[model samples]
Target: MSAPVVSVDATPVRAIALILIGMACISVNDMLIKLLSGGYPLHQMVFIRSVIGIMAASVFVWLEGGWRILKTERPGLHLIRALLIVSANMIYFAGLSVLPLGLATALFFVAPLFITLLAIPVLGEAVGRHRITALFIGFTGVAVMMLPATDWSDIPRAALLLPVIAAACYAGMQVMTRKLGAKSAASAMAIYIQLAFIVVSCVSYFAVGHGRYAEGLDSESLIFLLRAWVWPAPEDIWKFAVLGAMSAIIGYCLSAAYRLGNAATVASYEYAALPMAIMLGWIVFAERPGWIMLLGTALIAGAGLYVFARERHRAAPGEVPGPAAERPLRRG
Candidate 1:
């Protein structure tokens, strides 16, 4: 009468490598989205990306066994999971448009901490003193990142909360991924995510496609959020296409990584996204991280990794109930 345990491979080398690839793809996708934010609406980009992503994900569904593979026993959970991630993306991308790329991504890295805390309540899991200490350290890192060294002067105060809130939603979606459904194909879950994205983006278009509602907002983040859709530049079509493709790949890989790898082991590898964000920011945006930012990054990544190490050390043999991120095929 219980749900099946996640599919976990003992040596998930392929899963780890695949998720690292997914992290890299996500970092690149985040950069491109930040680049495009100045000229386009978030919803517009999401809409385009989803359209293309659904098409790409459809190929995956087909490969899995035609469209029937998309069917699921838990449509409601799928719907909730999809909306959580869509909200996460919209918030994170809007913040990315204004915040430094490295800092924003680093902030989002606190998602693991959110997972630990969420697991306690939602999964009825207990948090030990060690993880409690880890939480304290993890949050201190967040405060460090928020210091003036990161240049809070130009940032809209509200924008500072965006990634953190996004992180919470992302964490919630992932927690549910572990608890929800009767275990479906990665392709099926992926298709559900893309379809949810499609529906949300269409609703956004109807709500604010013309920018008439954005008449007075001056914050760059708000502008990015409320901006009207303009046709993609001929040259930028490729970026949207790439984002769509990468979005699909990121979702599929994250699902596979969590499914195949020990949740504790695989969760540690997810930190790879922090460094990828830093490297890509340096290369593409020329954003330099000061020592303060570096310290913040170290604390966030270290705290998260340490949590996994502890989980591995203390848990009983067999499958450990570690955090598994599905992005929920979610986040940018």
Candidate 2:
């Protein structure tokens, strides 16, 4: 379904519901990638998902207007935006292939901190003392979450960077999205993103999908990157379809949520993904964070919410809302 365009009469409750559903889809997508990461090349999985995602995005385009909405004035900017998001997905999937779900999810929460910081230079947005403090607390939470992990040394230090770097790319995409304004239909944006995935994955497949470079790789992430493309096992085929479908669902719902709901309120609700991710990690993978890590996760969420609140407060009566973490963080 098409997301409602932003209107004066907002339906905050329905927007809240949409955000919950979107986050759930994201959590499922993450789990699927992690599961698939062990067996198939990342490009192979991404190419399949992108192919399916293009079809689903077509439906959204149809629902929004028609194929005509795909037209854009700034093709280069869109390509750059698509590249940023795809980079985020690849890096995150690499990390998720090795890290526990809960820790990875918590690390990704640093996106808000990145957004707030990046906004200043990239968007020329003003930041006050309070929001700055929130950024510090959120990053401190990242350190706190990792500090107590007895097994942290076992993980390749580089593997731990997957979520944070991915988050930075995601935030960069959002900044570009903001600069692009609300001119294009969200579905159109999604289509190009899928296209970028298809092109990039195809290139990767041709370059190294023969497993030539995968021979001596010890890093799970690197092996995942260069491994030969395999025909997915029969049972895993449907899971790939689910990943594509989930991507379309996420694009539509998050777009609709931000448009239809109060930005600050709806953005705060997006934090629900943290708990959802953790719970799914526990149930599906039998992984759970310790109390200390949970506390750190809470701190990260609190800081993000605090930033949202500050954005709301800074938006004087009838003035345009400042940027918060309206991240279209489609999971890897």
Candidate 3:
């Protein structure tokens, strides 16, 4: 008997599943950071995590034909992509330490909008009426999410902007990743990104962490950013390793998902992170998002879905796939 055949159409389903599971892993990683932010400096956490992540990523790179798979012609592009991912990580964590996980994750939802906008100019992808409309609706969602509420006085002003900025940086990284996906190995991309994180974390530790902030700088965000490093307890070493392993997993899954599916389809599935973040926030931190936030999330999801549908419609049978969909994953 012949083995059952898998349809090519199932690629999207596999991509979506990979992305959703990846997001969940990321949320769990975020939860660990949020839990630990009160005690350790952000750079310290990142330094340790990246060290572990590099080790993990290196093993994967080795297993994928012993580092030979990492050869790349576009070293400059890889460096830029690495910087984007590292910057996004710092900004998002800065906001996350203060903002509720759900809200911070919600704000990062604007990444799809940024990605769509970037693609038009950077990749020369065409945008039609439907995508234009989707962009407007998505921005409206961002506006709704950012509007000051009656309780707004309780939240720091900087907290509101950081995650959105992070989202933009992340979107740029995603676009660049897709552009490079055709030639770059997934392990190579991840290894480069992790190395970037390590370099940035070391620089940050020497630059910002050497000078201790005055006492009583206790706002969650400020403390996370400015606190002097503390030596990790023996048990904490294990926790940091786990965090790094999760980061490695996140990098692999995200790279694979984009490599396998169209960017629009993969990006829309990113919204799945919001709900996972919300649940984790509620259970772990007692965060309850207001009704207004829920409305904003709904708008963002609807707009993203519309964009996904439009992208699918634009792809006609037998026509060439765009840059995003054209990249086939190369095996070593």
User: Which structure among the candidates has the greatest lDDT?
Assistant: 2
Q: Tens digit of lDDT per residue, candidate 3, span 1-332? A: 11123333659888778778778878888998998888888989988988888788888778766677777777887788778778888889988888888888777776766777888988888877877887898878878877787524578776888888987887777677677643565677778888888898888888778646725775777778878888898867778888999888787777667666665567667777788999999999988878877888887778766766776677786454443233211100
Lowest lDDT sum, 10 consecutive residues, model 1, at 323-332
TM-score of 2: 0.93
Candidate 1 lDDT tens digits, 97-149: 99888889989988888988888888888788988888888889988877765
Give the lowest summed-lDDT range of ten residues in model 2. 1-10
- The candidate scoring highest on TM-score is 2
Q: Model 2, 249: alpha-carbon shift in Å?
A: 0.9
Please report, in order, the local distance difference test score of every candidate based on alpha carbons.
0.79, 0.81, 0.74
lDDT of 2 by residue, 1-332 (tens): 22345763457778889889988888888889888998999999899988988899899889888988788888888788888889998998889998888788888978877888888998998898998899989988877866746645477877877898998888877777776663467778778888999999999988998999999878888999999988889999999999989888887787667777777767788778888888989999888577767878888888988998987777766666666645444442
Ranking, lDDT, top scorer first: 2, 1, 3
The true-versus-predicted C-alpha distance at residue 163 of model 1, in Å, is: 0.5
TM-score ranking of the models: 2, 1, 3
Runs off by more than 4 Å, candidate 2: 1-5, 151-153, 180-182, 325-332
